[model samples]
Target: MDQGQLVRILLSLILVVGMILAAAWAARRGGLLRQSQTRRIRILDSQRLGARATLALVQVDDREILIGVTPQQISLLHAGAAPRDDDDFRSHLDQARSS
Candidate 1:
């Protein structure tokens, strides 16, 4: 290969790598790659049930819900007021421990 061809090849590789890195950086900075953050809804916890199923605790507005999730479906299992303070969290923990 001639010097011009080698330089072109090198420049193309660098441009491709730079584009990929720039896209990744933009996504991270823009929060496009992160979970949605909203005051009305938040995922508090989750546990995998099987290969494609999970149980999730989601807080929505003033309430929390227990949801069952699978690759094919989503179902609500329970719903209640969400804990808003340390005392409420402690009480819920105590109730869970007792039960």
Candidate 2:
């Protein structure tokens, strides 16, 4: 192809990529791309025990669940009412660990 044609194609590609990036930036600034404020389920915390194993504290509705996650399956360690504070969560975690 001619040098002029090649330059035109390159400019067109750059312009398209620039437009995509600008649209993403504007959406993020406008909060259109962010996660919603009101979600029913939330992961309170998690700890990685091994390469493929994780212990996660998840809150759903008004209850909290301690779950063990692995590649094979997810197991519920404990399920109880949501804790009021971080300290309460820690105590629950300690109790779960001991059991």
Candidate 3:
């Protein structure tokens, strides 16, 4: 191959790699292109999620539940204790959900 062709190929590979790295960095920083993934909202939905966990909201269940988990702790929530009063994370979760 000609020297010019080799140079162009090398430049193209570098540009592609740089773009991929930039995209990954942006996603990690929660940029407009890519955003951080979280489990908060999925668990916040009442229909999809079970057992209310808020103060303004009433939770009737004996234990707070975490749904849509990896099956390891998904069912464990059924037996776990719910946070109550200021110590309750469910209430905090509600606030986070709003945000």
Candidate 4:
């Protein structure tokens, strides 16, 4: 192909790439691609057991779950009520001292 045809192709490719990047930027700015502010499930901690295995502590609402994860599947090791915040412990201590 001629120099003129090569330049046209390069410009078209650049324009298409720029349009895609701009669309992604616009979606992020408009919050269309953002995760929700209020998430019910959260990963509290995680530990790698081996090459393909992982132990994860997850909090879902008021429950704390211990899960074992591997390439094949995820299994629940244990599930219990979530621990109370440090503030709750402090408050209880203060009440006991006053009583």
Candidate 5:
């Protein structure tokens, strides 16, 4: 291709990339792809066990649970009520943050 044609191709590529970035920014800014408001369950912590396995601490409503997960199955390891005291919950949160 000629030098003029090469310049046009490069400009087009740059414009395309800039447009994609702008679109992504706009979507995020407008909260078009934000997390669901109705989603109740949240993962408090997670650790990888193997290539396709993980252990996760999940919080649902006022309950906390530890679950073992694999590609083929998910198993509940433990379940307990969340701490009711503010001080205890804060300490637990601090411990989790430190880890």
Candidate 6:
């Protein structure tokens, strides 16, 4: 095979791998969001769900939760969080940040 063809093949493989990884990551996040959303709805109900306009930072057991609510609805969602402990939290964060 020519050098150009070999390089093209390699680049194509890399691109494909990158795309696969991206899609997998996205799917993972979507799954997590659905699970959390489902849990909130089941446990808390729409009445407890907060509005997007009113949001407050609520921390619990190391994990930070963003509680947003309006007069009609309430929801407990994730915004951004820091590690709880140096060991367990770090490992969890590493896995999350990886895949």
In model 4, which regions exceed 4 Å deviation?
70-75, 82-99
Sort the candidates on TM-score, descending order: 2, 4, 5, 1, 3, 6
Candidate 2 stretches greater than 4 Å from native: 82-99
Model 1 misses residue 96 by how many Å? 25
**Alpha-carbon TM-score of each model against the true structure:** 0.52, 0.67, 0.38, 0.64, 0.60, 0.33
* Candidate 6 lDDT tens digits, 1-99: 999999999999999999999988998988843555323222222233233356666655445667767776767767456666679978989999999
Worst 10 residues of 6 by lDDT: 38-47
Q: What would the per-residue lDDT of candidate 3 be over residues 2-94, giving only the tens digit for each residue?
A: 999999999999999999999888877876655446423223334423353322222344344543443234333343465477657677998
Instruction: Write candidate 2's Cα lDDT for 1-99 as tens digits.
Output: 999999999999999999999999999999999999799999999999999999999999879999999999999999996548888889999999999
The most accurate candidate by TM-score is 2
lDDT of 5 by residue, 1-99 (tens): 999999999999999999999999999999997998666899999999899999999989778999999988999999996668998889999999999
lDDT string, candidate 4, 1-99, tens digits = 999999999999999999999999999999999999689999999999999999999999879999999999999999996778999989999999999
Query: What's model 2's overall lDDT?
Result: 0.95
Per-residue lDDT, model 3, residue 65, is 52
> How much does candidate 3 score in TM-score?
0.38
Instruction: Judging by lDDT, tell me the better candidate of 3 and 5.
Output: 5
Off by over 4 Å in 3: 31-78, 85-99
How far is each candidate from the true structure, as Cα RMSD in Å? 7.2, 8.7, 13.7, 3.8, 9.2, 17.7
Candidate 1 residues 14-75, lDDT tens each? 99999999999999999888866666888899999899999999988878899999988999
Which prediction has the highest lDDT against the true structure?
Answer: 4
> For each candidate, what is the lDDT?
0.92, 0.95, 0.56, 0.96, 0.93, 0.67
Candidate 3 clash pair list: none
Question: What value does the lDDT take at residue 8 in candidate 1?
Answer: 100
